[model samples]
Target: MDEFRFIDSIKPSYYRQSSVIKGVGDDGAVIQPNIGHELVISTDTMVDQIHFNLNNMSLEDVGYRVMVANISDLAAMGSSPLYYIVNISAPNSVTNEDLLYVYQGMNDIASQYRMDLIGGDTTSGHDLVISVTVFGNVSPKKKRLRSSAQIGDIVFTTGYLGEAGYGLSLLDSHKHDKLNYFVQRHIRPQPRVDFVRVTTNVNRICLNDVSDGISSELNEIANASNVSIEIDWDKVPIHKDMNHLEHSRLKQLALSAGEDFELVGTCSKGDWKLVRSLCEKDDIKVTEIGKVINRGEEPSVYLNEFGEKLSLDQSGYQHGNS
Candidate 1:
């Protein structure tokens, strides 16, 4: 099938969210925004070989992973996903049926997350690249920006760290398929949208998706908030499966191997009580990983590992540097 036919076929499968007044087949998507709410939008792209490899991941996993990466951005902002646009560029090596499988993965996430797939472009290219832009909305007062961190606030994570990174490693090493827990975490990360939804009424927050790992994320928050943060290595949560890893490898993965898709953020010490209470109600456990210590020029992040205060470098995957 050609580009137009592919778009036509997927039109009916789109999840028509109330906010999307018009979707697929149009020049643009028409969206009805909620009154008194702030619009939250984020975009992400994944390329074959650079971002994903078929040897370890299916085309569908690539599609699903890209969508979740975008959705996690919305979750970090404490917003509910409303609509999304996806652009797929496929090479001669990629077939129309393969694109459909990718779409199925995207559609699955959209259905499960209550967002609509609206409009985007399809093209033949030298590489298989999927780009997604997601739209969400939150109360104006509840917006969670990386700059929102405050001194004395408690830093937290939505779930276990390092699982996704290890999962991808398992696939790369050809040791386990996608069904493995760590592998599943890498391929299909669960965005913390539900937790954000439940705690929407909480105080202002500082948030960054652990898309690039906690080290990079914490540095971002520090630079944005102009605040230094301190955290104990032992406080960093990990899966029981990761316990077998040597101390150095576990530390390396938790610190710099990104794509966890969990939210790392901060709230007032008092507000954390409410946040924890709210999360526990849904059987979700948000781990308190650290605390903001100072606010000033030249902000930095310090990790308390092996009872030593060690400053962290600006870490995680750099797209073009590799």
Candidate 2:
């Protein structure tokens, strides 16, 4: 049989639970616990060519990132991860050592997050692809969504921006140490679990994972909340390393370049100081970057400094753009 036909030949199985069961679906197998909470389930895929270049990334990084990126989605929802399922596809040319390194990397991250690897599928493919479905739990009342923001809620991001794009820039020059931090940020983007945990009590009004740049994510949140967002350029946190780029271009990059893997969230005005202190206690840098305004502003981002509004033409890196 052909490859596509072969994959299609296998049928998915179904399962049923007793009367106490809450929900179950193919996205993930779930069961209600004695405690009342809605378990959030999500999955993500990382392709060799599209998500990471095999030539540029190590085997270990590939494995770790596949899990971390999926975990990021759960973190944005303030979910406590319980377990995960991994599915990997690789070519015959891939060596045993490479495969083992990838597994090791996955295990290392899983152990740190105390996530259990419940099940998975292994398959042979022409190239490489890793997909993971992570299961997490959060109280229904505490669930954070991008659609919940109210006008006047202050916007915040967990860390400085543009490091991932900057790291990709150095790959050509092969300047490893010159941009070690950014490189690491891209290779092993940390899942902001603890930080999300800290903000859970502050009534996290809205939430987004900064996989795409701030502009893209801000636009998404604004559209969801039916509100306009105004970001102060000066208020957007920029790391010292980001200063390597030219002034005008760098600001644009920081605002538009994607894959920063930070958390951008909203909080009521009164909770700012308390949230700031909570993050400080956890050693996480939280910056007040913007605010949600009336929808009349049309969901735009701005650079208002020195009484001038500079134009940033790029809308971040899109997959198919040349």
Candidate 3:
């Protein structure tokens, strides 16, 4: 299969958008955004063995994961996904059929979010690699930030944590059949794009998607916003399937297990009430797990379990860290 044939084969009408004046066949994509909307862009790259293993994830899963990872970044900024460009580096071992399956997976989710595929490059490489760059839009007034958290703000997270990590563990141990939910969570993590679209419209929401673990995300918010944070252990929403695990183990996964793709952030208590109320109407579960505090004598992030405080270890998937 040649490169041009491969491109033409996966091209679909759903990837076309009014905003995209020209896409795919052109030398470069041409896009025109609405008058009052600001563009938001994010890019993510995944390597075969480093980010995924064919033994555990199929080609479709790999493509879907790369797309979701990039979209999650847009969601963190309170934006709506608009368009995307995907670049692939495939080895000789990968077939055109396999590549089509990957594109099919990407298109399935892209259709759900109303995102279009623009243009990108494909090349030969020693290992399979997928790189996705996503474009989104947000109203200037409604854009959220990690550096906007305030003292006395309430911290919150969407859905359950630890499920993706537990899923990865199951995959590693080849126990995927034991827990379908956890396994699915690992391979098919959902981004909180809809949640952000609804909640951040009210403003005063400082949020980020938990791609690197909630612990690292909280610390980032604290450092960026120059505030301290205290998370209540009991309030952290661990998946029910993880109930069989020890409390300490559950806590560790909930805090440091990356790739959950759930939103975690803060809002003023008053704004939180409105956000929570609006999210509930959409059937989105938002849990208040912690609070922002003045940076007086406390660490950036700490865990509070039944009034016992412990320092949170901001250790997750850091590449090259042995």
Candidate 4:
């Protein structure tokens, strides 16, 4: 939940690199020095109480999340992750063995993605926290942006919505499960890097990771592109465990709940067959809930099922919330 507020405070030397890359503005930064190679950079921070609780979170899961969060940013930009830098801050209450386990978790996932750990920083703090910065490579023209969404582009989401949010609901309800699949997602959410790798060849015009839930992501895209979104509430996919009642609230949950780290994107109508084929080959479910529209003067979200334009009470979870 750590925020970046200091362009002039953190490091003034990065100013030179800012022009070369789309720095400190977009979901991730970009650098396209060569015509053939473009560089992508993104950073994420998880703090003790803001992002996770140490009493419930395992050291390994925290470590894995340290890497996954950064990788998610790269995936959203339609780039391939190459390397990462991680910085850890922890209190003396954490043992050296615990920190080593965290590093081991980082190494394990980084290897899976073939990302090399180039460098990082470690320091003592009052609480446990992790910050990871990831670098990826993409073609200059191929780098997707949130603002690239066009009016008439179909909206799509990779995989189900509200599963992680549903998982949190269960934990809040005190119903622990032996499966623990959803809980792990909350702790160690898997970034859809493989999905990104395949979809990069498709017509994904604009893309963003659904970390802050689907509603907030859609709003971001809408605001960026200055278009309205009309999503089918029934079409919003839900996990099998989530029954009709749960599914009914999924529109609200998926829209407002944070930490559902799926890919939300826009594609042209012509690419439907190709996109569906890719989803089939990869065994990922994608649902088309809406289309970009220029009907309204102001950008808004409309729910077809409710037959009215819906308003969201929450804009995903913000930092420092209990």
Candidate 5:
């Protein structure tokens, strides 16, 4: 099928939104946000082999993942996703059926989040690349920032860590059991969009998505907010599947696995209690792992492992790092 036909194949009424004055088929998309709301925009690109292994991941998984990566950014800022544009470049080796499945995958997530597929472009390339640009809205008072973590604020995360890292390991071993929860996580991560929506409604503060590992994310919050962070090792939530793994290795994965897509942030103790209670009502688990310390500390991130404090290693998925 040709490009036009491909676009037509996936067109659906569900992809349309009132705010989108014009979507797909136009030179550009036109969106109008409601008054008293600020728009949050984020873009992310996923390259084949580098970001995903085509041999291991399905076309649908690729599409879904790209959307999650971009949407997670919006979620980190306490914004609700409104619209998105996807640009895809696929090699000659990819079939039209493959491309359609990709769109289906994207549509599934878009529908779930009530987001409109505004517009995008498709082209041929040496390898598959899916670039997604997402738009969201947040009231000015509810907007969260990575640089707003305050001293003495309690740090929390939405869910357990290290599952995605374990999942990727299983995938690398050519394991194809869909029943394996860990393997499922690596391919289709569940972004903490709902958590952000609920928490921001109650109280908003310093927040970020754990896309590049908790260690890297904590360092980012520390540097951005000019504060030191101390994590209690015992309070960190580890995936149940990781119980069999060596304790040290599990800790390493929990700290450095970059694809978890969980939310990490800080809030006042009172706000933290309120947020935690609200999340609990929705069946979402929030764990308080540490607190923000004063600035000017020798080490920005400290880990209290069995009462032996140590500096955390800032290591995770760094593009181009050998």
Candidate 6:
């Protein structure tokens, strides 16, 4: 179908939020910001084969993946999702029905978070591309930032890591026997938005979503906060499915492979205790991986493996690096 028809076809019957004054079928989307809250916005773009491969993932899965990528950023900021805008384009080979599936995919995940679909452009392109911008709100008092970590703070993670990257590998190798858990993680990973919403009552928590892997996120926290961080290799959580992988390879996946989308953060000891209990009560696995320290001139992340202290480089998925 054409662009206007595609846009009109996916417009919601009703907006999820009353704050959305003008959504689809408009020159611009107008939103009313809530009082006593700051807006948290995040956007992500996914290319055809680079970000996703249709061999293993469907267009709808791509839509959900892109939407989650942005929502996960809001989760890292401890914000609640409010609205989203999706811009999609594909080549002539893709039918209107295909685009419908894409929009259906976006709606599938977004509706769960009470996010309203706002305005975005739709047009033809050389490749199937999807861009999503998510908007959320956070209380100014409970801001969670990468630079908010403190010395003596405890490092923690919301859930298991490296599954998504491993999942992609499993898909690439056509390992159907071991595909269910990891494949789902690769295509339809859930953001830890609820965990943050429940456990962020604490005053200070430094958070980075594991979109780019734990090492990258940890280094970001350390650099942003100007503090050194050390996490034991044995403490990092990996799935039982990955236990058979070689030592260094498994650790590398857990440390450097990206797209897991878990939340890694630091908070004070008391605050960590409180959040740990709260997370358990909510049935979310929260693990104490290590602690923040002051041993380095330049802020850096160190992973303790085989009793050896090794500095962690910014090792994760970097677009266009390959």
Per-model TM-score, in order, reads 0.95, 0.84, 0.94, 0.83, 0.94, 0.96
Candidate 6 wrongly placed segments (more than 4 Å): 177-179, 316-322
lDDT of 6 at 310: 79
Q: Clashes per prediction?
A: 1, 0, 0, 1, 0, 0
Q: Largest lDDT belongs to which candidate? A: 6
RMSD in order of candidates:
3.5, 6.5, 3.5, 8.4, 3.5, 3.5
User: How big is the positional error of residue 78 in model 4, measured in Å on the Cα after superposition?
Assistant: 0.2
Off by over 4 Å in 3: 14-16, 297-299, 316-322
What tens digits encode model 6's per-residue C-alpha lDDT throughout 18-74? 999989888999888999999999999999988988878887888889988999999
lDDT of 5: 0.84
Q: What is the lDDT of residue 78 in candidate 3?
A: 89
User: Which structure is stronger by TM-score: 3 or 6?
Assistant: 6
lDDT, residue 8, candidate 1:
83
Can you tell me which runs of candidate 2 are displaced by over 4 Å?
A: 1-34, 177-179, 297-305, 308-322
The CA lDDT at 119 in model 6 is 85
Better of 5 and 6 by lDDT: 6
Assess the local accuracy of residue 202 in candidate 3 as a C-alpha lDDT between 0 and 100. Answer: 77
For model 4 the local lDDT of residue 94 reads 75
Ranking by TM-score: 6, 1, 3, 5, 2, 4
Across residues 254-297, which tens digit of lDDT does each residue of candidate 5 receive? Answer: 88887889999999887888988989999998999999987664
lDDT of 3 by residue, 24-110 (tens): 887998888878999999999999999999888888888888888989999999888999999999999888888988888888788
lDDT of 4: 0.72
Q: Residue by residue across 14-55, what tens digits does model 4's lDDT show?
A: 333222444443444455454577889999998987876656
- Compared with the true structure, the alpha-carbon lDDT of candidate 2 equals 0.73
Local distance difference test scores for all models: 0.85, 0.73, 0.85, 0.72, 0.84, 0.87
